[model samples]
Target: MTTPGARAEAGTTRFTVRSPRAEAVWLCLFAGEAETRHAMERSGSDWTITLPGDLSGTLYGYRAAGPWAPEEGCWFDPAKLLVDPYAVELDRRFVQSPLLATFGEDTGGIVPRAVVPAPLAPLPPEQPRFARGGLVYELNVRGFTMLHPDVPEALRGTVAALAHPAVLAHLSRLNVTAVELMPIVAWVDERHLPPLGLVNSWGYNPVAMMALDPGLCPGGVAELRRTVEALHAAGIGVVLDLVFNHSGESDVHGGILSLRGLDDAMYARAPEPDGRLINDTGCGNTLDFANPAVRRLAIDTMRHFVTHCGVDGFRFDLAPILARGPGFDPAAPIFAEIGADPLLADRVLIAEPWDIGPGGYQLGAFPPNWLEWNDRFRDDVRRFWKGDGSIGVLATRLAGSTDIFGPQRVGEGCRSINFIAAHDGFTLADMVAYAERHNWANGENNRDGHGENFSWNNGVEGPSNDAAIIAARRRDLKALLGTLFASAGTIMLTAGDEFGRTQQGNNNAYCQDNAIGWVDWNARDLALEEHVIALSAARAGNLRTFAQFPDPVVWQSRDGKAMTVEDWERPGADWLRCSAPGTGFGFTIDRAERSVNIDS
Candidate 1:
């Protein structure tokens, strides 16, 4: 099962690849434009070759001989050398060339080559600390500290910036258990971005899933290890947001990147009649994880991160795709394997819970030990605070949405992750000030981004000069923060949301990696930051209020009387109160819950 790519032995190195469709496979070595090809022996689904003498630091690739029929999904081009699917390191950036899509041409100098590094050391002993009912602060690698003054000028926008004393101190102050970093894996710009003169800073469109982006991790895995070590020393954990649903390679017309060039069968292609790609993700190609080889690739990639880079967990983007056979299933092989894997059993797993594909909104259907982003909680809380409904639904969300998460309450804390804003949508500030999306700068003539953002403009659409409107907006922001903290589930806060960071109402700033995306640290609203700090500390002090069981909630009406079923169904009844024991705090709409004294 471990046989994949170059692995150094006592005095020799072995190269293995799984190409079920290829008739023959060759191990090609490159040295100063001179090439040497060695034919590989076939063993079922694996093709392998072993070479003697210490063969570390060698640059190599592979070529498979087979059919070249794209219409039926067998794309085997012996001339267009392929990258090892398990390549740990790439020598340079993958330069896009039109010749890569065609067959039978010696692409000697242009294709990316895999590097065999010296033997790696074992990872640190696993001691994951992320679990239920803790805070997770999500931040972007480059944009997080790009403008921080304390970070070194050279390392301002790299992974190294995260370990800087200033950044670590700030994280420590927030009391979050983990930092959920956005995609750090190697990715490429979309084909359309070049004509519009834009860059892909989000790194979601990944080509090499295992390789870390050079711009972020220049020293490769060593840099990542150092950052992880630093965070562990500071009592913080790292959670990587991974995107394995699709690759940077688009459809047939798009460029042939890593996986597609190696084998077209790796993707989830449509059934007969059309034979087109199953674009479940908004991205062009969805990986066929039902294939054993692709499943192995994904498992091996996660193992490498855990055994080499010391990552604590993974937050899968568009997670439903990984469980697709004919349709999404909770018992998908990948899920079963991860649940049973020794290395991953204790690691925290989170899911974005939906995609553009059919039957993709499988929110509470994930297996146990996995957490999900609660969009229902987000929307309900937003609508309630924005004056669309009563506080009844919001009360349910603050109690961990037992009706949605499950009445059983199998886990100790909560399975839902509560948040008012995230990366794809508007910031906390923009959410309160924008009635509609302002994505005119995304080059789509303002037609892009979500239509219903659940946002309110307070009175004016954009920036306001009225004192009453400003005060109300600030109050609403604090109320939202309090509700998030007072909730029973894990709370999430974007990097710069505490001090009112805004993208000028650009709900979708995925492509605008300029001032529109980076956190403006210089314009910190100190008052708002301090207020959030107090809210966080208060939340921590009152954790006992949310007991482990789902039955901790005891609902009451505005008059402090127990509510009946008729009261709950009453359309006119708005104000509600929910109380729990030990934490001495109460969840109420118009009034604050009295903190009970233990002395009594």
Candidate 2:
């Protein structure tokens, strides 16, 4: 295993090889025929290489010479120019080309290689300060800024665009404390994308955890750093939505781009009893956190982000998979290691809290100091506001879902990261405008996405010119936002949801990289934006009320009756007025001390 300090230099790149049975090995750089054969000496099981010249635009890969055997788990295909697991820059995106051969094929025992450019110099780190209660704006890089006409054309679709004055000004005006960027790491197009002429988006299929997606930062790390700095200057934190549960590599037949070539043992391969790679992640092989070496690799990847890229925090996708050790255990060593790391202890750590494996839905199981993506809160709120389910579930979720998140956590209020809609599912507009998921665009013939959406079209499906339906949808949207803000928890709003962004009814847009997912800043809905801004201000400006312990706020029905635990369980409760002292907004109720002093 490589030490943390080994590759901490500006331009140094490292690779590890495990050929205990081999005599010698060399690290080769493959840019083109002219510079294809430059070799570096190996020290022990590791090979270290520093480019001879400027490696920014240069393309390179590796060739390891070792014993050739298939059954012994040693398929040394020196002919294949393997990608460095720690590669920072990739020349071309991985496409399912015939160039990728099977492991058994020993035709010259080599495979075509993809060139990886040298790492850019690390950026100066920026540490952000997050107050206890603040609104988080979750956005996708390409989707958020790409269609904004106010931004410069060159800057669009890139990280630099996010720092553009227009973007920053909008975020500042929105009063958001942090911008939760959806997966900016290098990812791969799903196998179905090429045929449908679409691309894997939402960036959930990550190929590298530490490296930024070159597609999002053409100018490279320097550009990304500038963006982070700009956000920090605006008092806005940047948190990356990370997918560490699995790689772009699918199951056994998946691409051998990086990890598979470097070390398959680090990944959770199929158990030999059945010899099928664990498909816990539902995307591909689940990472084997059971291996101490793999755990170190994950930690190293996160450290690179903090020490090099200057990110504020990470929201782990399908985080329950990280704790699975043959079975789910919240006290897993990986969590313990991260919680104890001095550098990472203060950083924001969030978990998606579930995977496809058995017992994967461990919502409140995370240790203290970590926030969890509260899907129950999202679903119950949606259902209640849509008038589909019991308001009791909504009440519990609003009160911080104490049933899920135990009462012993350390956060001021709810450690729940509450949101009605996120990247993986429908946008806010579609949730109230479509009763069922419309995922035909994903090439799965509408078979993809969640079945129990708990959505309502309010008398019409898809687009409706009816004024009443439109008004109802808008009200429902506001109500959902209101519930999210009024509830006790950390609030996260999807980027375009503030202005009612829509995917034309497509709930699962993981494959639509086109305009379907992009936010149309040109067609701004002023009224909707104002509502969102007001709610954000209320949350940020009224921290005390939201932070109150035991009973933060009291809710009462319009009929002057205090809503009980039973009323919350009853369906069809359209609206409830909640009152709390020290809240920025003033309210009047029948009870004594009718006025609650607060600050806005």
Candidate 3:
């Protein structure tokens, strides 16, 4: 198949786009305020135009003409500026407007233009820097460095900020194997957010798959490539968190941004009678993986990052949607397709592993080579620390979730990315500081985030002035962090979690791009940060032992007696220690004192 999007040649550039249902497609180029629309010739399902002169850095977009039936999934309005699906750079960020939805309203003034990318020599294929069963640090690029004082003011809140010495030192201190960056791709604010004076802090609502968001990554692909190279120099890998299940174009009432205007069939639809768009991702519309064209786009997007940016791997948000052909198929063709692609075959693949669709909760359903975000580990660990969970269940999770991933465990290479908290939920500090979610600021009447967080405030609900309450919260935080570091698997630590960063109890601060969302580096808990540093160093030194639950292990009581099944199953059993010979490691969890002692 011919590569889609603009390709610069010796003296001319060839532009291609796939709009099978469109009767006609035109390539619109921008020079200053003037725009030129060149009609493209159709060959099969694709539209092409070979323009005179190398058009690198030129601003361009597409306008397709076709049927406008939204119900049957044919949205092609020439007035709507369509971003190239394979675009790697954009002149500006996306914004929401009602004009984007109204037919023939002319969104040329509102929509962003895709920039013709300069040709880059692909990186020599090398083994990924990330290793299995290593610490995966998750972070939002903008939020992570937005308020960092050490980062230059000019570079704050951008991908370039990640290459700062301060940021590198922090990641190195955590002994991070890979930094799983949250969505950095171009995304538009949700329609409801502008009215509320809020913006999407999380880039989950993506528009173009390959284009980097200008706000977050001002230098485009070059900025990302530079950052990745710097991180590699620091012995840290880079994994992008990509959203393939849905697009920011949203539902029928939403905008005709890119694929929707070019090829509406790019989205999955319900069985004919009504033919409504599938809402599997709960992000309005689900990208149709069943369509071969869509699969090609997904694969091509992965290749672009790996070849151009030299990223170690990707973490698929709402990954179950990748396998859904209306129903979840364990043997989805995408799994085999990615495995077969040479550029992506060795790249680390992590899956969120669930969506809102039927059978979406496919915990251990991904291919063996892929690592899955273990939400079970999050909830069960939270439950145990909250004091209502079973020790046996906690033990299973700490032992690598053998029930979910099959018995060939972490000792061999665990498939679980264990975490007690992630970006979607409460921060690790809030888990012990706020019993209930305080998301009143999200403008959804305090009802936007998860209600049952399995959280427990020590004494007071929000902040506390009492020294005892403060001490207790710190102890609980240490216990939780210790449990995570001691767990058997590739553990993940969300940025700012090493120190104590809070959203003022906002479990879902996805829209708070301000101080409420930014990490308060000035007010960080230094002691907690040091504790995490120690844990990270110990985990790195004893990685072989910490990667899996030790065999020939003895579960002992506080008195050092081998614990019986009765002791293991005892209700309110809070303390236990485990040790194995020759591994040079042992650990004790004493929930009564809110502490975890790691000996390695």
Candidate 4:
């Protein structure tokens, strides 16, 4: 089947745009810097125009004339130009302006030229190589190599640098099976960031879902393919963390860059009782799956990566928003389609299965084959080790979280993606060094981040030179990672967490595109780093013990008696053992001393 966007067809080129709410659609072609506009003929929901010249190098944008009712979700204007949502490459980078949402605002000067790329050589099909009981490293492309002294200066911070032997050798030692990259898709900084001298360091706010961001891909998608090939050679797969719930275009008052300017129904808008765009993604707008075009874009973008880029899997950022129907329906077509899709059926699909909207906390509600990020495991593990809870909750998480993804559990290939820290929150060093979010540097008056972090500071709010505090911090850090490594199912470690990177206590470092967010290898704790490597190796060696029906975890009080029902949640005992004898593993949680001892 022919792909959706503009493509060379026969002797002529065909341009297509999807505008279900338009009265007319125009295809504007730019040749030799001079523009020509032609009315596109309609065929059902798609509008197409065929011309007699090779439009491969020619620049083009679409404009749709439709009803101008912002109240009822129709904001189509012929004066403003729109980018083809399926455009593979662009001549230049994209910039956002609030005037893009204004009616009759001609954006001829700033329209991003959609480049007609040369036909790509057929990519070799990738067989799924990722599975349970391996480490998944979350890395930021630019920040990862930006400060690295080993990576060549010319290739530093570029996608090609990931293929360098220096970086691969480092990852190989960590026993990483897959590198889950933060959003590398073309994204724009948040509207309010420019005035504060900040940029979207993390690529969560995306504009073009298909076009790889130039900041990450200086050598284009080919560099990404080369990096994937390199990782495959090293036995590591690539999993992209994608945000399909919202675009960089913020709220009603935000920029109308691509998706918002193309079609209003493409986004979900509530009708009455404070009529406005739904904020399911907490990013001001939630993409509407009620529109088939939105669903097509989500599915097709994933296929585009698999078909052209050779990605092994995808971790859907704020995934529940992509499955919304009245609310976040478990049986939404997006889930059903991917589950039944020939291309995606066997692929490794992960979900950040929640959003900021109604019924959004759907941790274990995803389909049978889809694995989910286990935040409960994260919180419970931290709380237990922090001496704030009992062995009950921690035992459940370590045993593959049967209560959440239960009834069938890991045997059905649905294992929790366990993690201690990720790109969003405090780093491993900051987690024990700071008790609260120190986001004053974010220019939001330290009021912009999460309130409850579930962290303990070992009697110090920030860094300390005291022998007792430092020793306690290191011990607690080892216990936390030891818990994640001992847990069943897949494991993920944030890029710098293994080495104890800190953000000066800043929990929401999303806006800081500087040293605070970059993974600084220079300030690493060598002992901690080696400790993490050991945990990863041990995790890799226990894959079979991790997948089972009757979970291997058994909870026992210090007296060696099996824990009673009352002991599971409310603990009167100060210490207990969490063990799986089949795996020759167990941990003694000593609440009195606030220490953990692993008994093999």
Best by TM-score: 3
Taking the candidates one at a time, how many backbone clashes does each contain?
A: 1, 9, 0, 0
Q: What is the C-alpha local distance difference test score of each model?
A: 0.79, 0.70, 0.92, 0.80
Write down the RMSD of all candidates, one decimal each. Answer: 3.1, 4.3, 1.0, 2.4
Candidate 2, residues 142-187, lDDT tens digits: the string is 9888889999888888889988888998999888888998888777
Misplaced by over 4 Å in model 4 are 1-3, 31-34, 272-275, 408-410, 547-554, 565-574, 591-600
Query: TM-score of every model?
Result: 0.93, 0.89, 0.99, 0.94
Winner by lDDT: 3
Runs in model 2 with CA error above 4 Å?
Answer: 4-25, 31-35, 38-45, 48-58, 65-75, 103-127, 408-411, 547-552, 559-561, 564-575, 582-600
- For model 2, the run of ten residues with the poorest summed lDDT: 589-598
lDDT by residue (tens digit), candidate 4, 1-600 = 335678774678887777777899888888766878899988777788888866676778888888877777777778887778888766666666666767788886676767665567757776876867778999998888988889988887788888999899999999888999998888877878878888878888887788787667866667888898899999999999998989887887776566665667788878786678988888888888877788889888888888778899999999888888658788888877887787877789999988888888999998877889999998888788776766777777877787999754445643689887888888878888888999998998999987888987989899899999988898888888887777777889988888888888999888877888877879889999998887777656665555442354677987888888877767545677877666576667676675666553
User: By the TM-score metric, which is better: model 1 or model 2?
Assistant: 1
* Rank ordering of all candidates by TM-score, starting from the highest: 3, 4, 1, 2
Between which residue pairs do clashes occur in model 3?
none
